[model samples]
Target: MRIAVALFEDAEELDWAGPWEVLAAWARQFPEDDVEVVTVASHDGPVTCAKGLRVLPDHTWETLGAVDVLVYPGGVGTRRELADPVVLDRLRTLHAEETLLASVCTGSLVFAAAGLLDGRPATTWWGLVERLGELGDGVDVRPDARFVDDGDVVTAAGVSAGIDMALHLVARLHSVERAREVRRYIQYDPEPPV
Candidate 1:
């Protein structure tokens, strides 16, 4: 399984890191499964996160391979990146490839900007629900869901919610038992935010 986690200038750190940890742990725990996780960006270079963590990409968008799971995380950069034709074009291309796409926080904004969520129910980083209304009419926009699974697309509410989303994926892909084992390994026992 080839998973590509897209990054950008000012990308939310946890949006990528939280899920990255889960998937990476999966590959490490189950070495028999070939899960190659790679970080990608629009260009091949260093990207500094909104939190100040600088990361280097394994590949650029143009050279990416067939991604089984394509994750686009959000941050302050999204408000601007969502408007870039190149970014939206790449996202639309990835969506057309029939690959599973996921997002965290305002990451859905990118999907919305790409017109993927135009008529589909979706959610985002809470407060913006009213503002993200362009995603079609009466879209549930369940801001309360820790994460919503709408077939090939999965969306998490906020930053930390991504952890739960990743765990759910583990349960879905392998087994609930495996997911539990992962949660236990990570000390993320079943508990919601306080």
Candidate 2:
């Protein structure tokens, strides 16, 4: 599986990193899975993220070539990118060619903007549910789901929830046992004190 994590200006780091960690660990521990992960940007070179994190992309949309899965991360950037023709066109093209498309946090808004979530049950950062619903007329927005799996597209709510979605993807693609192993390897037993 070749997974491309789409990065853009102001993208939430964990939205992409959480999944990257899970899939990358699975690939490392179980080499037979053959999971290849890379970060791609709409343009070449560096992107400054929402919280001031800078990332140099591995490839650009024009260079990423034949990705099996594409993970779009959400952040403040999505607010502006919701109507960007370049981003929307690229996503539409990828949706046609990619086997699966997943989004973390507000990334679902981008999918919604591209018409991928029309009549599809999906989730996003809780606060954005109303806005997302507005983007897709028939969108069945799930404000509480950690993530919604609608066959070809999967959408995750808020930041840390992405880890759950990534683990789910592991189980979906491999086995429950494999997902457990990856989770254990990451020591991801979350016991939040809030």
Candidate 3:
């Protein structure tokens, strides 16, 4: 399975990195699973993230082949992507090809703008739930969900939530045991101190 994580300028750091950590760990731990995880950008140049972290993508959109799954991260940059015809068309094509589409935070906004989330059950950053509903017709916005898995399209709520979504992807694609192993390997026992 080939999983491509889309990166762009001003993308939230944790939104993509969290999922990358989980999915990449799965690929590393289970080489026999034939899982390949890669970071992709619209261009070949370095992408400056929302927090100013520069990331060199593994591939550009033009260079990427058929992807089994696509993880679109969200941030302020997604605002521009929402109106990008090229990005929207690419997403539409991917959807038509039956590629599993996943989004974190405001990434769902782009999907909504691309008409991918119309009449679909989806969620995004808590603050943008209403905005998501406004963008797509009949988008069942789940304000409380950390992530909603709707078969081909999965939408994650916020930054750290992508980790949960990614682990869920591992379990869904492979096995519960394999997902557990990956989680253990990553030592992702979250205990948020309040």
Best by TM-score: 3
Candidates 2 and 3 compared: the better one by lDDT is: 3
Off by over 4 Å in 2: none
Write down the worst ten-residue block by lDDT for model 3.
114-123
Model 1: CA > 4 A from native: 135-138, 190-194
The ten-residue window of minimal lDDT in model 1 covers 131-140
The Cα error of candidate 1 at residue 27, in Å, is 0.9
- Kindly provide the TM-score of model 1 when superposed on the true structure, using C-alpha atoms: 0.92
Alpha carbon deviation, residue 165, candidate 1 (Å): 0.8
lDDT of 3 by residue, 22-136 (tens): 9999998889999999999988889999999999999999899999999999999999999999999999999999999999999999999999888989999988899999999
lDDT agreement of model 3 with the native: 0.96
lDDT of 1 at 14: 95
Instruction: Estimate candidate 1's alpha-carbon lDDT, on a 0 to 1 scale.
Output: 0.83
TM-score for candidate 2, residues paired by index = 0.97
Count clashes in each candidate, considering only residues at least 3 apart in sequence or on different chains. 0, 1, 0
- Report per-prediction Cα RMSD to one decimal: 1.8, 1.0, 0.6
Candidate 1 vs candidate 2, TM-score winner:
2
The runs of at least 3 residues in candidate 3 whose Cα sits more than 4 Å from the true structure, single-residue gaps closed, are none
User: What is the overall TM-score of model 3 with all chains considered together?
Assistant: 0.99
